[model samples]
Target: MKTPVIHLDVDRLIQRIALFALAGLLTIGLSVLGFHHWQMSDPYVRAVLEIEGDVSHGRAIFQMNCAGCHGDSGDGLVGPSLHSISAHKTRASLIRQVIGGQTPPMPQFQPSPETMADLLEYLETL
Candidate 1:
């Protein structure tokens, strides 16, 4: 009777584990440095109202509700371009439009006051 011997490749296994570790570290470093990109805001959620808001949440809300009509960068689409809305219209007006609703083809949004203000902050950045 004969027994076959099995050998383990320890060096190759170590190299593979090291490669994975390096990849993980690189990913963490890139994320910390914001190599991830596409983040809407990072300036500590700058709010401009008496109330408070988060720029990140506002950006998400805008993408979901506004971008379809207003364009991603506010360059305008079905709705008017909002790049300079702050300069053209007052903050109150913007809030009103968001809460109350505009003319035909423009539906009203029921976002909270905080959401509205956050959205305004994001628009200002535009």
Candidate 2:
């Protein structure tokens, strides 16, 4: 019986290895970029980091205007839970909700710009 000879393409193997390395690097780079962008673009994160209102005053406003429906902790009552309001809503969206008002249940509130800003800050604390 005769043994057959096997051939190996060393250059092709090296090229494949290099290609895989490059692809891995590219994937890592893109993932890092995406993660950084996600953190910066998060509405809640930005809301917390930026200072536009007085959280203490905002707490007063919340108790006065929102406690009836949202509960003391915003854990919800007649209204939906607002404990994580910033996570789900942007400051602009909140402002609109307060000013424009939603249909039924959620009443229309015309808070001054300062008050609205304070409210947003208080919400971020929640």
Give the runs in model 1 whose Cα sits over 4 Å from its true position. 1-49
Candidate 1 local lDDT, 1-126, one digit each (tens): 889888989999999999999999999998866732422242222233455657787888889999999898889899888887888766655665676676658897866567877787787777
Give the residue spans of candidate 2 off by over 4 A: 1-51
For model 1 the TM-score comes to 0.57
Each model's C-alpha lDDT? Answer: 0.72, 0.79
The TM-score between candidate 2 and the true structure equals 0.58
Model 1 residue 88 CA deviation in Å: 1.0
Clashing residue pairs for model 2: none
Worst 10 residues of 2 by lDDT: 42-51
Per-residue CA lDDT of candidate 2, range 46-76, in tens?
A: 5534657999999999999998999998898
